[model samples]
Target: MNVMSVRRAEASRRAGGDRHERTVWPFAALVAAAGLVMLGYALLAQPGWLTGLTLTVCGTNPTAPHAVLLAGVLLMLAWGMARGRQTAWALALCLLAWSAAAELEAALAPSPAAPWRLAPLGFAIIGLWHGRSRFRVPLNATRLKQAAEISAFSVTAILVVGGGGLFMERSHFETPVSAPDIGRTVVSMAAANPGPAAFDGPAWQINGIALLSGGLVIVVTGWLLASAPAPRPAGRAQRAIVRAMVSHPDSETLAPFAMRYDKSYVFSADGRAAVSYRVLAGMAVAGGDPVGARESWPGAVEEYCTLVERSGWRPAVLGAGPDARLLWEERGMRSIGIGDEVIVDTGAFTLHGRSMRNVRQAVHRTERAGLVTEVIPERQLDPGLAGQLRRIHREWLGAAGREHGFAMNLDAMARGVHPDALVAVAMAPEGYAVAFQRYFPAAHAGRNAALSLDVMPRTPLSPNGVNERLIVDMIDYARSHGYPRISLNFAAFRPLLARARSSPESLTGAERATIRAIGLLDPLIQVDSLYRFNDKFQPGWNPRAVYIGSWFDLPRFAVAAFGLEFALPYDRRRTGRAVTAGDPGFEPLKGPAPVEAHRAVRH
Candidate 1:
């Protein structure tokens, strides 16, 4: 699709109308102002004052308990409707219909505030109905169901528990109360603000009950309102299709990663090319180049870009190679060199010179320590040894979550899944696997098949330079096996950092500052250190970058990218096993590594 058609299609899909997907914010502002006015009237007209900013806004009135609920509910709906959610629009319509009837009745009764209230209500109801097509974004079915279930359960539990507590403590009330009065007070307090009921003494107990239960409901409600249109990730069938597309020999080295289970894809209309991405913090991060025929990339890019734009997510590309960067930059994206893909031409690679002295010595030392390297094809792997590789991967991860890398890391360490993959395992004379490297076939030119490193992991108790030893041995194996090249880790900022390290005096002031800033983060990401380790191989460095649709997207893209790479502290795990430093059996498993996502420096 052309860019214009792409935009129209996305706009039509999101809004059911093809003008644009701009959130109906003018209507949101009007709705919010109406809520504020209602709140102001509640506070000023009836001085049923409660303490604090929150209570003062949603003041109580026994004669109009619905007003307390309506004001707060309108404010919450305004936030959700601002996201253009159809659910919010639907809920607002129901509330508006009831509110309009009430206002119409009051207006007939000659109340001064009635006309004022009816005008905004009338306008809001009319505006929402007319622009309903714009609010076409559907609520996530799963989240919507959870919200409904919780809402129903909360109302029941609060009414039962809170009503029982209030009636039991009826002696503490300033005045006598009935079952109906107690019910209204309990329900109102449990949802919006405090009820009209007064206390003879402290209301702390009631406030605490409301807070414990009500706070949870509010959080759920907020989540619903803030939600964006979720990406429809590819299923098994789609992945199989993507696998076929990525199988083309001319595909990018990182294109195969597009088949990872966590991703969503946008295919060209011709079904020949596709872009895969994952959404984080409303940022759509595509890992690498579009997968498939070169000529179809434009359509894939256009569709992907337009889809994210329509869904209200900022689009970013992580670890995009040179050709892919141009594709993104042509769409007006800003590209920054974030890393380099290291590749050693196995035919030319050797540890013969003085420059390979460190690597050669490390290999010798590890071998002397009774460790030998062995290559096992994916189909030939022993089940027990495959289990050991997984153990090594988990142990090396230590305190980190398994959300390894969005671009280079495949999170694949098992057998049977990757038919052509090769596992380079380092074993002790005792026969246990101590360290290993996993390689995926990623040949591009008509030359011999090259391999890309997916995982490099080992026990911390293992000897230092294990990764280097693994790399050297793997290259030797590949050279003999007809694979003429080996792709190693994607070392972030290796190009400029290596330049600065070898020629510090040549760096500009800005470059020095950038290096220093990156150095500070090295303790977390192993940025410069990983680059230095890769540099020793004297491999060819191909540039890779992160591309942002706009400079404003940098903040979201950076935060999401970093979070995905290093993982957040509270990353939840569904597995039965724990991997934290403090978990049982952790020290023996991972050694005495400190808290970090990836290991520091040495690896």
Candidate 2:
């Protein structure tokens, strides 16, 4: 019966220990409290009292207070580890080994006076080891650098304090203690009073102080070297590769944004694929679909997602096409269809059908106003004319009150023209350029299949239908050049909302409510107007979506996506009185010095 009772007791204790290991918060709180106490003691404790307790007959022992300081540091490390900081876990392990060494020295004392202090720290180190799975994230370069810096600083502070205490002892004592005596006194708690004659020995014999310090530096440096490297911005070599891969046939309408300077790129090993993204507020936001060969997209996209996850940031793909949305959905992400991209088939585009009455009438009116249109490839445009166009662009931007756009607009056009770009200019009766549009190449599979409308800026004095005439001319030009398509502006939720409103009987209660909410936002966002304008072209609408991993990250992703597209406060100041709106989805602006109305252009 006695043996059975003992066995039951042992089992109960083992079970209790297991439960304790799982309960991290309670242990973490206790460790944190201990750390606070140690810090307070280190900061407020009388240095004279500390020196008095550890002093040998020869000099004060400086290493004694260090055990308390180290305990404090280790407690903090444990606290961080409990919160799932991998770097803290790594630092805790290093400190646990260090604390054990300190305790061993204390235990080696002739009298076991200070060894009793090791129990709390030992339990904490053990607790951390048992709960190691909680800290699964790898320590990144930023965390590694921070840990290394703190360790190096701590070691330096300890050396400084020990050296200062030694100088004071030497100044006060007639028989000053040698470095070897101080070392032996700290480790063994026995004063090595080898006399003043011992000081005449070699200077390098200052015991193992330098050796210990050097070893600590090496350990910290090695840990930092072993940490994962930080993610870098896209460089020139990456830009070149992106330019090449963007020529893939299946690239989406917004793929041209990849070539912009503001974004970063991640590529596959063979350089046949890439993901262009920008990081803001700890979110890696890819504006559109991966730009690469269809076969290579899965690898490049996975690489990008993994890179973002390892860097401890949220990954969000905004304005992704149907194919990209399906891919993200397959990866367990939820997608919300955001909008529709309008693609006009240049071969079939004609102002002949009854549905095209508005566009045709507008084009004819603009033509009657003697507004001559000229279509020229970007590289063939004269430098002086390009400069004037740039000025017009800046003026138009200033009037529109916009400074930057990420998803589908150019932040800078004055740099020079892209080789594959096409520019269409409308000249007024006086011959000065009044309206202009820019088209970027949308080539695929070794063929320039489509042209993406990028910029459309006209002077305030130009006629209203200048844009319609320009598009008509562009379609004629594309047909002549054998290019098949022209991708126009995106219209957010056009058909769904339109259908919901037009045929209210078909929609469920939730759909009606959603439609009503979207309808309310039309004035502010111009969703309805943009859709209606694009519809006049009778273009094929391709679906675009923004899929997110976590619902909670929606607000942050919104900020990152729009913040990149919208102008800052300083840019608002530069915008003057114009109220700039609509980006990624092109809409008209309302302001002083409003440019002549043209067909809505989208990047």
Candidate 3:
């Protein structure tokens, strides 16, 4: 490779192979290496890095306690540098200068190579100063205070409990030890260096305390350095902006989903477009694509990435359509196809042909079972009726379930939550609302009304096919009135799953293994069951993909995506299969479905 190309390659690697991340020295890795160096000195009982210096400068492995504490601070600063935080830059300047001064004090004047020995460190200090403009993101005072308070509380508690305990039980030491000695030993243990403590025998209690203190320190670093600042909620002004942007007909089917209260929005420079996103596991995950003025999309995308970078977060998109996938690629992101959105043309759809037999039978069967359907704007619904639907929604999700929606589902069905959204209700023979499907209007002109399915839930006792029946009613209504453009449930890995279901023999063993693995999870995730339902609709499919800041993002992406979709690592600790709120849904790249996700046959 040529020199420039080689430099670029190395820079990319140093940047953790992600351009979206603000390139700072990888601080966590550096902290780890520093810990390793400390380990070397602790084990050898000599200062390895400082061994070249005169021995009079060193007293008993200075790397143990002091260096360990300094390493944590350095790690935090590295995080700041990655975030372009000004405070981190100022602190780093001081830290580097101190290290350089220490080196000078230790160096012998006669050694000519001493200058060379310090060149790399000198260059680093100079480079850091030269890059001052890169550090602009100031630490949020409130967040920093919280981190400091928590770390201080943890450390103080450990010292009081561990150090006091050790001092009280001085007999545990091999030799008689003073209170100050016990205090220093406890400090060393909190710094993850317990070996310096001279124990009389197998001191399990001290060791346990050391492990706890070390673990607390690790948590301290993560909380202070890597945790995202508390997410800013959309105020009246921003929510007004989002509502204004999403209400327009051409904002696309998924546009209204941007109004989900959980997400924070990023507006273009011109203030004409916005994208809604949430930060999870150090990633800013934009829900689908940006919405609003077409000309301003690039600005919105740039603004989103910039926001994420300023906070030291990796940028990602969860349900980007084909056009959006390309737009993200232009920003140097990599993407993989996650699923396809099923869009059915109302005028073309009919319960005819043998291929439509299953859905047709379902619709008829539900109708014969005394299911009745009604379509109306949520605005027209009675307050009592809305309460019933909400109840059913909760029951469908079960007791411990959360709505788990982002891209295509809203948390609740409150009025003005979704502008121009329609609700389709299916009632049982007994007269209660058995199930309901809320549809967000993509755009409505004259005879052309485009709708995308949003929230859907039904009671456990509801008969089979009430969902199919309700959907058919909406399709028939739209077809009779205007050019019906209806969107259905998103089918993830549809092609693969369909192939697995229809022709398993054609797949390689590895592919078969993957299919079988999903099948094993099918009882929990319900991937195959939903794919089967969408297939019968004979809808035209629009391919969709998920984008990540970089390949290194894949690991966290999986974890965050899981936590976001199923509340996996999140609170409530509810265990049952659960999908996010909607389908006939393309909260594309959605994870596990709630148990009975398909038993309810919701779309």
lDDT of 1 by residue, 418-487 (tens): 4556788888778898888888765434463577888788886678777888898788777776677788
TM-score of each: 0.72, 0.63, 0.77
Ranking under lDDT, best-scoring first?
1, 3, 2
**Residue 247 miss distance in model 3 (angstroms):** 2.5
lDDT at residue 532 of model 1 (Cα atoms): 82
Winner of 1 and 2 under lDDT: 1
Worst lDDT 10-window in candidate 2? 588-597
lDDT of 3: 0.69
Please say which candidate is ahead in TM-score: 1 or 3: 3
Ranking by TM-score: 3, 1, 2
lDDT of 2 by residue, 1-603 (tens): 697567556655664664354355654565565455444444665366544423321022424244344434546555454544566666756666676766777789887556654675577678778777655446666757776687868566645654555554564444667777555433331121223433333333333443344345445544443324334555556766676666667776678777765678888666678888877756787878888787788888888876775565667887888766655654545577788888899878888989999998889788777887777655556767777787888787675545566667644463332445568888877867888888766554334367778878888878888777788788877767666888888788876766865797998888888777877988766677778878889999878888776687799887777666665553222233211222244232111231222222221
Reference-based TM-score, model 1: 0.72
- In Å, residue 564's CA in model 2 sits off its true spot by 1.6
Tens digits of per-residue lDDT for model 3, 472-558:
888876665453688777778887887887897899888888788878998877787888888888888887788997798899888
lDDT of 2: 0.64
What's the residue-level lDDT of 311 in candidate 1? 65
What TM-score does model 3 achieve against the real structure?
Answer: 0.77
